[model samples]
Target chain A: MDFLTILNNSAAEILSPSTAAFALATIGLNVHFGYSGLLNFGQAAFMAVGAYAFAIFTMQVDPTATLGWPMWLSFVVAVLVAIVAAVAFALVLGIPTLRLRGDYLAIVTIAAAEIIRFTVRTSDYSAVTGGSQGLRGQDYKGDITGLNPLTGTTYGFGPWTGTAYDTWIRILAWTLVVVALILVWLLMRSPWGRVIKGIREDEDAVRSLGKNVYSYKMQALVLGGVLGGLAGIMYVLPRAVQPDNFATAMTFYIWTALLLGGAATVFGPLLGSILFWVLLAFTGGMLSGLQQIGAFGDMSGTQAGQLRFVLVGVALMLLVIFRPQGILGNKKELSFHV
Target chain B: MSETTTDGTAPTATHPLVDGEVAPGCKKVDPIVVADGVIRQFGGLTAVDVEHVEIPRGAITALIGPNGAGKTTFFNLLTGFDRPNKGSWSFEGQSLAHVPSHKVARRGMVRTFQLTKSLGRLTVLQNMLLGARDQRGESFFAALVRPLWRAQEQSNTEKADSLLARFKLDTKREDYAASLSGGQRKLLEMARALMSDPTLVMLDEPMAGVNPALTQSLLDHVKGLKDDGMTVLFVEHDMHMVRHISDWVIVMAEGRIVAEGPPETIMQNQAVVDAYLGAHHDTDLGTLTNQQVAQIHEAAEEEVPVGLEASATETTTTDAPAEPGATAHDEEGKR
Candidate 1:
C-alpha cells in the first residue's frame, strides 16, 4: 500500500464502529475509576453482556430462519441487557466489596470479569453462543448497507472515499460517542455527581450530611457499566461475537485511554482514546516499514507488537508515579486520602 | 431548704435553680429524638451506653464530655454515621434506628464533621453546592433538559453564595476549601450544613480548633440556628459555650449521660464536676471551673493584639471586673 493508502487504512480503523465502542467504554470507565474512584477491572463484562445479548437475541429471532428483526430493536435490546447486567454486576460486586478498602474492590472486580469471561467461554449451550470458537459471520451490515445512498455505488467527496458500510458505522459510532460524552458531562455537573465526589473524599462526612454514600457509589458503577455495555454492542457490530475478543487486555486498554486523556473531565476519555490509537498505529506502522527495509536491527514483528505494549505500560507507570492525575485530571482530585 | 434528703444521698435534686429550666419548655412537648437503651462497644470499651435520652425540638442542645466520653459516638449514632452495637433513636417521630445516614439528611437532618471534611479539589462554592444535594436537578432526564436543571443549579449556587456571605466567607467563596483557615473551614462547614435546608442541624465540635476571634461568631451562628427555628444538637467540650448558648446540656462520661440540665445547674452539680477536674478536688468551682478552659484559650489569644479585648472579656467573665488576673486565681481557689 502507498503511504496515503496506509494512513487512510489507519484512519479507517481509528474511526471505525469498533473504535467508537472502545471510546464509549473508556468514557464509562472514566466515571467509575476517574470521577468516583471506583476500581473496576472487568469493564469487558459489561461489553460482553451487551454484545452477547444483542447477538444472541438477533440469532434467536430466527432459530430455523431469519426473523428479520430490525437492527434498531437489536440495538435497544443490547442496551437494555447491558443496563441490567451492569446493575446486577454492580450489586454483586458492590455489596460485598464497596465497603472494603479500594484495593479489595479492584481485585474482586478483575476476578469477577475473568469469571464472567470464562463462564461464557465454557458454557454447554455452544450452539447459541458458538461455544469456545465463538459466533462468526454476523450480518450487522445488512441494515446500514441497504439504507446507504452509496449502497451500489462509490461515494467520493474528496481524496477520502469509502463504501456505505464504513461511512455508516463511523456515523453511528461517532453519534453514540457524542451522546455518551454529553450525558457524562451533564451528569458530572449534576448534584448527584457532587455526592459521588463527596463519597470519594470522605464517606463519613457524606454520611454525616445524611447522604447514602454506598448507594451513590453503586449508582455510579451501574451508570459507567451501562455505558461500557453500549461500547460492547458497538465492539462486535463490524465483526463476529467472539468470547476471546472480550479480553482482559481490552479493559486495560480502556483504562490506558482514560488515564491518557483525563479522569474527571468528560472530554478526557475521548481525547485519550484518539491519542492512544494514533500512537499505537504510528508505532505499528513504523515497525512494519522498518521490517520491509530490514531496519529492525534484531527485532521481529511479533517482538515489535509486544514492544508496543511494553512502551504503553512504561508510559502508564510514569503517568501514575509522576502524574497520577492523568493528562487532564485535577491534582487535588487525585489526592483522595480516603 | 434541705441540703441532704431523708435518704442522705445529698438530695440529688434541688439546690441549683437552673435544674428545672430545661424541663419547663420540654414538658408535654414532643421530642425530636428519643434514644432508649442505646449501647456501642468496641473491643472491651463501651463508647456509648445511654439508657434514656431525649432531644427537644427547635432548640439548641449540647452534648458535653471530656475525651473518650463517647460524645462523638453518640453523634454518629444519631446521624446514622455509624451503627451502634445496640441502640435505637428517632428523628422527629420517625424511628431512625435503621434508616441510613443519607436518608436521615433527606428527612431534614444534616450534620457537620468534628474535623472538617471538605472536598479539597472542589472550590468552596462547589463544596457548598454539594450541600444542597436534595435539589431536584440531578436526574439524568432532568440533566438532558438543560433549562430546568440549569435554573435549579443556579438557584442552588445563589443560595450557597448567600450562605457563604452570611458566614463572612463571601470573599473566599471561589477559593478551594482546603485553602481556608481553620475558623473559615468551621464556618464553611456550618454554612454548608444549612444548604440542604435541614430542620435539624448537628454540629460535631464546631468550635474545636477555631480561633478565639471567630469563636463568638461561631457561637452566634449556632444561636442563630435556633432563632431560625432549626433544631441544633452539638458535641462540645467548651462548658462556657454550652452555658452561654445551649438550652439544655447532656453530660456524657464513658458512654453514658451522667447529668442532664440547664447549663448553670449542670455546671455546679457534683456529678458534672466529678466528671471533669476528677474526684479529688475541693468545691473550688471558680476559674478552675469553666473559666480555666476559657483561660487556656485566652493564653492562646495573647499573640493577636486585635483580639485582646475579646480575650479580656473572656477573662473578665472568670474574674472580678476590677481585678482580672488577681480575682481569676482567687476564684480558681474558691468554688
Candidate 2:
C-alpha cells in the first residue's frame, strides 16, 4: 500500500519501450487515417510481420526452431524483411480496393491482421515462428543491449531505477520515435504531403489536377505500414515476441492513442501514446491499491484489470463526444465523410 | 442575320446551324476538340451519343441542353473523367480515347466540377497550388529534400498569389475553402483551374449557386479565356449568360445534337424552344401572365411547324424534357 511505489511505477511506465512502440504505431496510423483518410484497421498485422521477421531471422537455424543467422546480419535483414512484408501487404490489399471507397479497407485490413495472427499461432509454422510458445527475447536481447553506450551498472535514482540495458532500450526507442516524428513533419510540409492531404479532402479533385491518386494512396500505405513494422521491431526488444502481443486489441489501443492526441497533428500521436500509458499505469496502480485495502469488497485483481479498461473506454467516449477533431486536430480537417 | 465568327479569325461558308450552312455534326474551321461516334451508355440508356462534333478553337463555345441532355456527361467523356462506351475524341489532334483524367488535364484540357469541389479542408492557397502542373514537390522522395523543389514551390506560390489577387481571394488565402461562401467557392475553383494554364478550360455550370454579384465577374472571366487565345467550353442553364458570352452554341436534346448555331439563331430555332418548353409546351401557359402568355402564343404561332402541335399532343404521356433541378433524375435514368 506504499503510494510512492505506485507513483514510481507509473513514472517508469511513461518512459517504457511499450509507450514508445504505441507512439510509433500511432504515428503511422496518423499518416494513414489522419492525413491520408485511409482506413487501415490491420496496423497490428504490420507489427506482427516485423516482430516475427526479426525473431525468425535471428533464431538458430535448427530443425526444432530457427535460422540462427549472425546477430548483426539478422537484425539488418529482419528490418528489410519487415519492410518488404509491409509493402507486399499494402499491394495485396490496396490493388483491388484503393479504387473503391469506404469500409472496404477496414474490413480487409482487420481480416488480414486476424489471418496473420492465426497463421503464426498454428502448429505448421512452429519451427520458424515458435508457434504459441513464442520466440524468447533472451536469445537476441544481448545483441541489442551489448551496443549500450551507458557505463553505469544501474541508472536513475530510487523510483526511476533501471539497469544500463533497460536504459539502452529506452534510448533506442525514443531515438526511433524522434526520427519518425521528423520524417513525418518533413513529409507533411512538402508538396507530396499537400497532395496527400488533398486526397483526404477530395480525391477526385486531386485526380482532376493531373495527380495519380492511386499511386499516392499506395505510397501512403507503404510508408505507414513500414512505420508499423518498425514499431513491432521496437516492441519485441524488451519483451518476448509472442504472437498474442500483436493482437487486434493492439490496433485498437494504437487508435485510441492516436485519437486522444489529435489524428493529423505531428505531435499528437507521440503525446497521446505517453498520456495513454501513463493513465493506464496510474489507474491500474490506484485500483490495485484499493483492492489491497479491501475498498472494492471482493473484487479480485482480474476484475480490477477489466475495470481499468472500462474507465479508459469511458474517457475515450467523453473525449470523442466533446472533441471529435481530437486534441490538436483542426475541425475543418476532420472530413470523416471522405 | 449576317454570318459572323465571334473571334473574327476567318470566314468560312455559313453552316445551317449558324447563319451559314454548317449542318449538325459538321466540322469547324479551326477545331480544337474533335469527337467522332463518341457514345456513353448506362445500362439501356444512352447518356452521350455524339456522332461528330467539333469545338471551335480560340473561341468560347456553349454546350446547352435541357436537364439530362448529357451536357455534363459529354464534358465528363471528353475530359477523361468518365469513359465512353464506344467513341474516339482528340484534343489538339491527339487521340484521347482511353486516357486518364490527370493525363487529359496535363494535355491542356482541365475542368471544374458543377458542384464546386473546393477541397474544404485545404486553405485557399493550397487549392490553387494543387492546380500547378509538373510540380516537382509532388514526388515522395523529392518532397523530403526541400531544396529540390523549394524554388518551384516559391514560383508556384507567387503564381497562386497573383491568381488569388485576381480572383480577389488573396485576403482569404490562408482560410480553409469550406469557410468561403458558395459564390466564392465557384470563383476559387475557376481560379484554381487556371493554375494549369490549360489550352482548353471546360466549366460545368459555373454559374449555378453563384451569387448575382459574382456572376458578372464570372462572365468576364469566361470571355477573358477566349481573349487569351484559349478555347472555352461551358455547360450552363442561364440562357442570358449563354447568349452574352458565348461566341457559338451547341444544343443537345435527348443525348443528340438537336441544333448548333450562334446564340441569336439558337434562341429562335424551333428545336431549341421545344427542347426547353417540352412536348406540353402550350398546356403549361396558364402559369404565365397575360402579356407573357400572349408573347409565348405569338412566338409559337410564328415558329411551330405545320402539324407539329398534333404530334406534340400525342406524346404528352411520355417523360417531359428535364428541367434544371431534374438533372439528378436524368443522370439516374441514364444509368
Candidate 3:
C-alpha cells in the first residue's frame, strides 16, 4: 500500500469498532483498577458476559433469528446480564477476600476470571458458546445501521476521510465514552466519592467515621464492573462473539491503555486507548516494512508483532517503577504505600 | 498469730463502722457507648479486656493510657472494624455487638484515627465529601438519573465546603490532602468526620503529631463537639489537654480501666496517680499521705493563668523547695 493508504488504514484500525470496544473496556478498567484501586484481572469476563448475552439472546434465545428484538432492548438486556454476572462474581470474590489485605482480592479476582473463561469454554457449554470454534453470526451491523440517523451520503475530501460505517461507530463509541467519563467525573466529585477514596486510603478510619467501608467497597466494585460489562457489550457490537476475543490479553491491553493515559483522571483512559492503538499501529507498520526490506536475516513477521508487546511491557514497567502515576495520574494518587 | 488475727479482724470490725464496705461509683448518666465484658485477643495475647466501660453522653471523655494499652483496639471493636472475643457494646442504646464498621457509622457514631486517614490523592474537599456517603442517592438506578441526585449532591458539596471553611481548610479545598501539613491533615480528618453528621465522634489521638500552635485549636474543636450537643470521646496522651477539655476521664492500663472519674478527682485518686504518673510519686505518700495528696489536689485546683506555665511546673517551682527534680523542667528545656 501507498504511504497515504497505510496511514489511512492505520487510522481506520485505531478508530474502528474494535478499538472503540477496547477503549470502552479500558475505561471500565479505569473505574476498577484506576479509580477504585480494585485489581480485577477478570475484566474480560465482563466483556464475555456482554458478548455472550447479546449473541445468545439474538442468535438462539430470541424468537426471530434474522430480525431480532430491538437493538436498544438487546443492548440493555445484555448490559444488565453483564452487570449481574459482575456483581455475582464480585460477591463471591469479595465476601471471602475483602476482609483480608489487598493482594488476596487481586488473586481471587484473577482466579475467578480464569474459572469463568474455562467454564465458558467447556464441552457442556460448547453448544451455546461454540467452544473453540466460537459463536458466529452476531453481526448487528445491518440492524443497527438501519437505525442510523444520518440523512446524507458520506462526504470525504481526501484519502484521510472514511466511510459512513466508520463515522457512525466513531460517533457512537465516543459519545458513550464522553457520557461515561462525565458520570465518573461527577461521582468522583461528590461526597460519596470522597468516602470511597477514604476507604481506599484507610478503610479503618472511614469505618470509625461511622461509614460502612465494606458497603462502599462493594458499591465501587459493582459500579466499576457494571461499567466494564457495558464496555464488553459495546465491544462485541461489530465483531463475532468468541471466547478467545475476551481472553486475558484484552485485560492486559486495557490496563496498558489506562496506565498510558493516566489511571484516575477523567480523560486518561480515553486518551490512553487512542494513544496505545496509534503507537501499536505505527510500530507494527514500521516493523513490517523493516521485515519486507530484509533488515534482519530471517526475523519472522510473528516475531515482529510480539516485539510490540515487549516494548509496551518495558515502557509500562519503567513507568511504574520511575513514575507510577501515569501521564495524567496524580502523584498523590499513588499513596497506597505498597 | 494473735496479732495477725487482730489485723484481719480489725479491718472486718472497722469495715461497717468506716462505711467502706461498698465501693463508690460515678453517678449514673446517659452513656453514649457502653461495653460489657468486652474482650479481644490477637493470637495468644488479649488486646482488650474491659469488664465495663461507659462513655458519658454529651461530654468529652478521654480514653488514656501508655503504649500498647489497647486503646486503638477498643476503638476498632466499638466501630466494628474487629469483633471482640466476648463482649457486647451499644451506641445510643442500640446493640452494636455484631454490627459492621459501616453500620456503626450509619448509627450516628463516627470516629477519627490516631494516624490521619485523609485520602492523600483526593483534594481536601473531596475527602470531606466522602464523609457524606450515607446522605447521597445510593441506589444504582437513582444514580444514573443525574437530576434525581444532583440537587442532593450539590447540597452535600456545599455542606462539605462550609465544613472546610469552618475548619479553616477552605483555602486548601482544591489542594490534595497529601499536600497538607500533619496538623492540617488532622484538621481535614476532623472536618471530614463531621460530614456524616454523627451524634457521637470518637477521636484517636487527635493531638499525637499536632504542633503546639494548632493543639489548642484541635482541643477547642473537640470541645466544640460537646458544645454542639455531640458526645466526644478521644484517646489522648497530652495530660494537660486531657484535664482541660475532658469532663470525664477513663484511664486504661494493660487493656483494662484502672480508674474512671472526673478529671479533677481522678488526679487525686491513688490508682489514677499510679496508672498515669507511676509509682515514683509513692514517696510523697508518707506520714502526711492524705495531707500531701490533698495539698497537691488543692494546688492542682488553682488553675494556673492561661498562657502561664502548667500547674505541674508551677507546683514543682513553688512546693518542691530543694528537690533535684524541681529543676527538671528548666534542665530539660535548656537541653
Identify the leading candidate in terms of lDDT.
Answer: 2
Candidate 1 colliding pairs: A210-B102, A211-B102, B284-B335, B285-B335
DockQ of each: 0.32, 0.47, 0.27
TM-score of chain B of each: 0.76, 0.80, 0.75
In terms of DockQ, which candidate is stronger, 2 or 3?
Answer: 2
Error of 1 at B101 (Å): 1.1
Model 3, span B224-328: residue lDDT tens: 888888988899889899889987677787788876655655566566667766778657644667888899888876755532666656676756646676677
State the TM-score, rounded to 2 decimals, of chain A in model 1: 0.88
Question: Per-residue lDDT tens digits of candidate 2, residues A134-202?
Answer: 888986565565556798899877655778888788888889999999999999999999999999988
Q: Candidate 2, which CAPRI tier?
A: acceptable
Query: Which window of 10 residues has the lowest lDDT sum in candidate 2 chain B?
Result: B4-13
Query: Candidate 2 vs candidate 3: which has greater lDDT?
Result: 2
Model 1: per-residue lDDT, tens digit, B1-335?
Answer: 13312221134443222222233112215467778888899999999898878877877889987899999988888877788898677777788897778888889988888888877766789888888765665554565566777778888889988999899999998877777788898898889889888899999999889989999999999999999999999999887799899876788888878876666566766667788878777756555668888888887787577587757766666655466665666578688
| Interface RMSD for all numbered candidates | 2.6, 1.9, 3.1
* DockQ of predicted candidate 2: 0.47
User: Candidate 2 at residue B5, lDDT?
Assistant: 45
Q: Given the true complex, what DockQ would model 1 score?
A: 0.32
RMSD of each: 12.3, 8.6, 12.4
Q: How would you order the candidates by TM-score, starting with the best?
A: 2, 1, 3
* Candidates sorted by DockQ, best first: 2, 1, 3
Question: Which portions of model 3 miss their true places by more than 4 Å?
Answer: A1-3, A65-83, A138-175, A321-323, A330-338, B1-27, B137-166, B265-268, B273-335
